[model samples]
Target: MPSHRPRRLVAALVACSAALLLAACAPTVALNPAADANDPRCADVIVHLPDTVADKTKRETNAQATGAWGDPAVVLLRCGVAPIGPTAKPCITVNGIDWVLENDPASPSLRYITFGRIPATEVVIAHGKNGVTDAAVLPALADAIGAIPQQKQQKCLDTSDVTSPTGTPTAAPPATSTPTPTPTPTN
Candidate 1:
C-alpha cells in the first residue's frame, strides 16, 4: 500500500506540472503604452470592456494599456493615445465619435488608428490568409471608446456645415426633375 501511494502522488504531481505549463503557454499580448496612459478616462473605458470583440474572445493582455482578441491576435486595441489633429487623411464618424483611419498597405496587415478621440485608440488587424478586415472589428469597440468624453478642440475636428461669406449654412439648390415624355400616342 505504501509503494502504491508514492506512485499515485508522483502521477498527481506530473499532471499538475503539465497543467501549469499549458496555462503558461496561453496567449499573451504585447502592447506599447499610449501617450494618454495616465489619463483618468482610460480607467473608465477599460472596465467597460466586453468579454468579446468582433466575434473573437478577449485574451489576457500583458499591460493595462492594451487589449487583444483572437488566438493569433487578429484584433489589438490600445487606449490613451496622443490625440490626432486635422490632416488630409479621411475622417469618418462612427457611433458618434469621429475616426481617422490610416492605412498602410505596405505592411502585411492593415492597421487602422482611431483619429478623433482625445485619448485615441489603435486597432490592428492582421492581414493574414484569413483576410480579416478592420471593419469586422472596429464597430465592436466604437461605443466603448466614445464613452470617453471627447475634448472636441483637442480630439476632434468640427464636422458642422461649412460656413459661407454671410455665415449662413450652405444649402444645396432644390433638386429638379423633368417629367418623362409620354410615348403612348406613338405606340
Candidate 2:
C-alpha cells in the first residue's frame, strides 16, 4: 500500500509539470473591449469574421467585439468603436468603403479605421514583412464593415458619382467626344 501511494504521487507531479509547460508555450493576446460591443451589427460582424488575416492564423481573444491573428497576434481588430470626428488622418476609399489611416510615429503598429461607418471598426497590425498590411486586411473585412448602416455624416462623395447637396443622386454628364468625319476622295 505504501509503495502504491508513492507511485501515484510521482505520476501526479509529472502530469502537473507537463500541463504548466504547455500553457507557457501557447500564444497570448491582450486587448480591450469597445464601448459599443453589444451592438447587433458588431455581433453580425464577429460571427462573419475570417479564419485568418494577412496570412496569419486567427486566434481566440478575451476582448469583446474583437478578433486576433497570428501566434504573437500581429493583427488585432476591434468593432463597435466610437466614430472618429474630423481627424486630420489621411483617408482613402477601398472596395467602396472609405478608411482613415492614423499613422502615429510613436507606435510600432499602424492603425486604420473605417470612414463613415457606424459603430466604427479599428484595426492595428504590426508592420508585416510586406509593407502593406491594410491592403490585405481591408478587402477581406469590407463586407462585414459595410453591414453596419452608415450615418449621413459618414457618406463619402466620389467625384465620379453625380449627387446633389440634398443627397439625391443625379445623372452623370454625357461623355463628350467630337465626331470625326472622313473626307470623300475626289475622282
Candidate 3:
C-alpha cells in the first residue's frame, strides 16, 4: 500500500504540470467589447463561432462576444457594434451575409462591419500573416455572423438600386393610352 501511494502521487503531479504548461501556451486575449456588447443576439453569434477560422485555432477572449484566432491573432471578431446605414464603402455578400468594407489607408489590417444587421458585428483581419485573405476570412465567419438578422431598410444595394434625390425610389412613369376619337353629333 505504501508503494502504491507514492506511485499515485507522482501520476497526479505529472498531470497537473502538463495542464499548467498547456494553459500557459495559450494566453487569454484582451479585447474591448462594443457599445452594445450586452445584446443577447451577440451571445448567439459567439456560440456559433467555429473552433478554427482561416486555419487559425480560436483563442480565448476576455470580453464577451469577442473572438480571436491564430497565435498573433490574425482574425479578431466583435459583435454588438453600432449598426451602419447605407454607405459608399464597398459591401460584399458572402455565405448569405453582407459585410461592409471599412478601409483605413494607414492600417495594415482590413476591417469589415456587418451592414443592415441589428447589433452589428465587426471582423478585423490583419494581412501579411498566415496567408489570410478577405475571401477566406469573410466566408469562414459568415455562419456565425449571420446569426444577426439584417434590417431590410439598411441593406446594401448597388448603383441600380439607388434612390432619387428626394429619397424615394425612381419608378417609371405611368403608361398613357391614346383615346378614341369621339363621334360627331349631326346638326
Candidate 4:
C-alpha cells in the first residue's frame, strides 16, 4: 500500500487537470446582438466607398444613419469614384466577404454605391460631382446590394432619442362623476 500511494496521488492530479480543461472548453449559449447591446463583440458597422464619391456625401450619410439607430454604430470608411467602369470596379472585401459596386463611367454623374452588413445589408449612395443621382441606376444599386428593410436595419443604427428627463410631473387626481338628484321625490 505504501508503494502505491504516490501512484494514486499522481492519478488523482491527472484526473483533476482533465476535468478542468474540459470545463474551460465547454460550449457557450449564443446571445442576440440587439438584446445584448452591451456585448463587446457587437460593435458598429462600417461601409467603405469607392474613390469617385465625394467626401461630403459620405459624411452626411454616415451621420444620418448613426443618428437613427440607437445601439449599433454606422461609419463610412471611404468615398471616391471607381477607377474602372461601374461593372468593373474593384470589389471591396471585408471579413472575407466581397461587396460589388457599380462604377459606370459613361454616366459619371451617377452616385457611387457601396454595400455592407453590420448584421444587415447596408447600401450607401454617393452623389456625383454634379450632385445628380441616376434615379434608375441608383435604385438598382440598392437592389444589387440587397439592402435590408429600413425597420430591419434600424436595429444597428445609433439613435440618440433615448434620454433621461430632468423634471417630474405631479400626479393628477382621479375624476369622479356627480350623481343627478332623483326626480321621484317630486312625484
Candidate 5:
C-alpha cells in the first residue's frame, strides 16, 4: 500500500506539471474593446497646390512657392475634391484652386482632391496612413460647395463588381413558386 501511495503521488505531480506547461503555451488574447468604426476625429487633412498646376511662367516663382511651404511629408495630386468640415478654413488659393489649412501641427490630417485637374501637382498632409482629408470630409463640404452655382459634386468611382478584371459571371438564382393545395372538407 505504501509503495502504491508513492507511485500515485509521482503520477499526480507529473499530471500537474503537464497542465502547467500547456497553460503557459496558451495564446495571448486582447481584452480591450474594438476600435470605433465611425470616428470623425480620424479625419483631418491639409491641401497644398504647386505652382506648376497654377501655371506660373518663371522657375523662381515655382521654387519660391515650394520653398515657402517647406517639404511636405506626403503629397497626392489630381484625385478628387476632398470634403471639408465646418471647422476648416480656406487658407489660400493658387491658380483658381482653393487650399484648406488645418490647425494640427503634430502632423497633417488633410487630404487633397484633384477633381480631374490635368498635370497633377498638389500636396497633401495628414496624420497617419488613411488619415482625414478634404475627401474624408466631402459629405459636409458638398453641401457648402453646392451653394456655389458653378461647383458640383463629382460622382464617386464605381465600386460595382462589373468593373472587376476577373470577369467572373454571377448567375441569379431561379425563382420558384410554391404550389397551393386545396383543403378537403372533413366528412
Candidate 6:
C-alpha cells in the first residue's frame, strides 16, 4: 500500500485547520476585570452562567469573572464589582434577585448593578431597535447571579413599605415586567 502514514498525517492536519478556522470565527471579547474579580463568590456566579442569554450564545471574554453574549456582544456581565450603596434609582426583583438600575442619561444601554449581593455583579444590556430588552436579559441571569448571597440588611423595599403621617400605607407601584427606556444606541 502506498504511504498510508502520509495519508493519516494529512487528515490530522486538515482537522486541525478546520478547528482553527472555527475558533477564529468567534472573537474573544475584551473587558476590564472588576475590583474583586478574583473573589471566590464570583467563581460561583461564573460557573452558573447560561450557555445562552436572550437567544444569543455565550462568547469568550478576556477578563476574569466576566461574560459576553451575542455575536456583537449585546449583553456583558461583570461580577466581583464594588457593591452598590443605597441609591435613589429604581430597584426591581427578578427571580428573587434584586438589581438596582443604573440610569444613564440618554444612553441606549440598561446597566444593572446587583443591589444586596456582595462582590456585586453588574450586567450591561443593549436595549433598542437592535438589541434585546431587560425583560429578556435579567431573568436569564437570575439563576447565575443568585449564587451570590444577598445581605439581609439591604433588601429592596417598595413604596408599599412607606406609610403616611397617619400610618396609612401608600399604594404599591404597578408591577412592571421590566424597566422601560427610550430606544437609543448602546454606544
TM-score of 2: 0.65
Q: Return the lDDT, model 4, position 22.
A: 79
Pairs in steric clash, model 6 = none
Q: Give lDDT tens digits, candidate 3, residues 37-121.
A: 9899999999999999888889999999899998889899999899888788888888888888889734678999998898999
Q: Count the backbone clashes (under 3 Å) in each candidate.
A: 1, 1, 0, 16, 20, 0
Model 1 agreement with the true structure over 1-187: per-residue lDDT tens digits = 2568888999999999999999889868777777786677777777767778777788888776678888877887788877667675656666666677677556666656666566777777776675466666767777677767766554444446435476768899977797778777663
Off by over 4 Å in 2: 1-25, 105-107, 128-132, 156-187
Per-model TM against the reference: 0.67, 0.65, 0.77, 0.20, 0.21, 0.78
Candidate 5 segments exceeding 4 Å error:
1-74, 85-90, 103-122, 125-187
| Candidate 4 wrongly placed segments (more than 4 Å) | 1-43, 46-54, 57-90, 94-97, 102-120, 131-187
Evaluated against the true structure, the overall lDDT of model 5 is 0.35
What is the C-alpha local distance difference test score of candidate 4?
Answer: 0.35
Error of 1 at 129 (Å): 1.5
User: Which rank order by lDDT, best down to worst?
Assistant: 6, 3, 2, 1, 5, 4
RMSD of each: 14.6, 13.6, 8.5, 24.2, 29.5, 18.6
lDDT of each: 0.72, 0.79, 0.87, 0.35, 0.35, 0.92
Candidate that beats the other on TM-score, 4 or 5, i.e. the better one: 5
Q: Which ranges of candidate 1 are over 4 A from the true structure?
A: 1-21, 105-107, 153-187
Which candidate would rank higher by TM-score, 5 or 6?
A: 6
**Per-residue lDDT of model 5, residues 1-187, tens digit only:** 2568888999999999999998665433212211321122211111222332212111221121121121222323222233443333334433444444544445554534323222112344444653444443333233222222223442222335126566778899977798779999998
Q: Say which prediction, candidate 1 or candidate 5, comes out ahead on TM-score.
A: 1
Please provide, for model 6 over 129-158, each residue's C-alpha lDDT reduced to its tens digit, 9 standing for 90 to 100: 778888899999999999988898888878
**In candidate 6, what residue range of length 10 has the lowest lDDT sum?**
161-170
Q: Write the per-residue lDDT of candidate 2 for residues 54-149, one digit (tens) a residue.
A: 777778788888998887777888998888876656777778778787887356688888777778999887874543366787787777777776
lDDT of 1: 0.72
Poorest lDDT segment (10 consecutive residues) of candidate 4: 66-75
